[model samples]
Target: MLMVALCGAVAGFVLLGHSWLQLLIAGALGIIFTQFAFLAHEAAHRQIFAKGTTNDRYGRILGTAFVGISYSWWMNKHSRHHANPNRVGKDPDIEGEALAFYEEKAVPRTGLRAIIARKQGYLFFPMLILEGLNLHYASVKSLVTRSEKPTKGRFVEIGMLAGRFALYLGAVFWVLPVGMAFAFLGVQLAIFGLYMGASFAPNHKGMPIIPAEVKLDFFSRQVRTSRNIAGRFWPTVLMGGLNYQVEHHLFPSMARPHLARARLLVRQHCQDHDVPYTEVSLASSYGTVVSYLNRVGLAARDPFACPVASQLGRR
Candidate 1:
């Protein structure tokens, strides 16, 4: 992780003197930031260390300083996700603030929001261009407003986030003209958001949304709600072990290297128990997510196509 961060920094520094072509470097750095975020995620899950404090120390540094994300905020949200993946009202990921992930959420929209809700599936990827900004905003918001009682961790993360932006933005402006620097940053943020969304969305966006009142055993809950992307080497490296999301959710602290073996074991166990397990190619997973979102969006459009309307008539 340290090596990757150092290499990214050196590469960015070397290319800063270039003209608008430096936007390429910005895009590459965005990828590097996503990679660092993956590592920070593992650290937050305790997959990198035995000691809790040790994991947090490295996670904070990697997430805040290198990736410019708030570790504490991510930890709080992600912990709930792991605990209750698709559970309604529990999983923060599905409580879409900008885009609706389920039918009921979409059905309540009005005006322009209603129009957007009806076509949200198609807009999802393009809208991800703003996700980088959204993530940064959410991180800062969580730290500043959500921290009911301020702690040392909050202060430390605030400082790290401030320092990260200062150094990163300072270097870009120092090397390029104002307009060029803004364009470079724009490219970087767009790529970062797109890549980050692509990798994480496939894990559970299309999976079953467990109603808040429903309950299931741990194994069933995790396996049923998670989708694994098919592949071993490249997928693991690309998604940072998130490709094996079933195993990761089942064994939150499992190291990235062991997810393959764990996947085999978990698959066999699920088969023996007659529990469903979903695994699909990366492209196919994206298709399913888009289709699922569009189907849910039906609730905001034609009543005949809306499942909620059907249910109401049945009642």
Candidate 2:
């Protein structure tokens, strides 16, 4: 079903011939690609295929080759994230080199970067244009230069990705003028970026930021730190069953189809154990994420503004 939709979208983009219709097809392609991304993510966690190796093999194509992302790189980083989400200095998601998501990383900045960092919450959506591109670049780079040891199928990965891009760009540029092609590419990538970010960020963005040294049990850690979005089919499809973020985090190997049922049991278990289970509407979760980012962004300008301290105060 997913593969067919993707092929149709891509085919329409190439065969439509007309520039305006091609642009519409590009939008469909972006949404379809994001769904492919979710499937690839599930594959990385061994949810799609029973065997890790099988999932990895297929995931490489869905992610690195067809989807233009590196599955190996995502797996390595995502494994760490699953093990210790929101942990400062550990979870790769919140790397502080550029914009800080947590109070610990929001020390202070100077110069133009600081000015931009101050408004990162607002800039986050717009910055995703390069983010989609960066995903491809990082994936290839990780495979190409992994501690000089190099990945096993590095050449194959490179060839597949090159072919995918060649076909994609070849179709676009061939079917349309150079300027329209660029515009089409821009819209497609931007939507992909926004779709990707919008899906994942709300899962943990506004939730508690665990300290690097904190050691909690698996169930507690996962449930406490992750937020679930309340919805059924559309949200599940869009989030790739990740609306049950807490459940997904707790059971990394579980299949996406089973996540919804599992969440009910997980929620009951958490209540039995007196653990806080954070769940909210999709809109609510996103609002919290935006509020959290803007709140943390305040710390960039005023050293006294600390979200961590504020959380403690509320507690």
Best candidate according to lDDT: 1
With candidate 2 superimposed using the best TM-score fit, by how many Å does residue 74's alpha carbon deviate from the native? 0.8
**What's the distance in Å from true for residue 14, model 1?**
3.7
RMSD, every candidate, angstroms = 3.7, 4.1
Expressed as tens digits, the lDDT of each residue in 1-315 for candidate 1 is 646666876676666575767888778888888999999999999999999899999999999998889998899889999999999999999996788888889888777887788778898899999999999998888778855556449989999999999998998888888998899999999999999999999999989999999999998899999999999999998898999999999999999999999999999999998999999999999999888888887678644455666559852
- TM-score for candidate 2, residues paired by index: 0.91
Q: Tens digits of per-residue lDDT for model 2 on 1-315? A: 988987788677667776676778777778888989998998888888778899989888898777898776787788888888888878899884657798656646656666666677777767766677778778778867758555667788888888989988997888789988998998898788888988888889888888878888887788888999998788998889889899888888898788889988988988897889999999898788777877776666644546577569742
Which lDDT values do the candidates have, in the order given? 0.89, 0.81
The residue pairs in collision within model 2 are: none
* Residue 281's lDDT in candidate 1: 99
Best by TM-score: 1
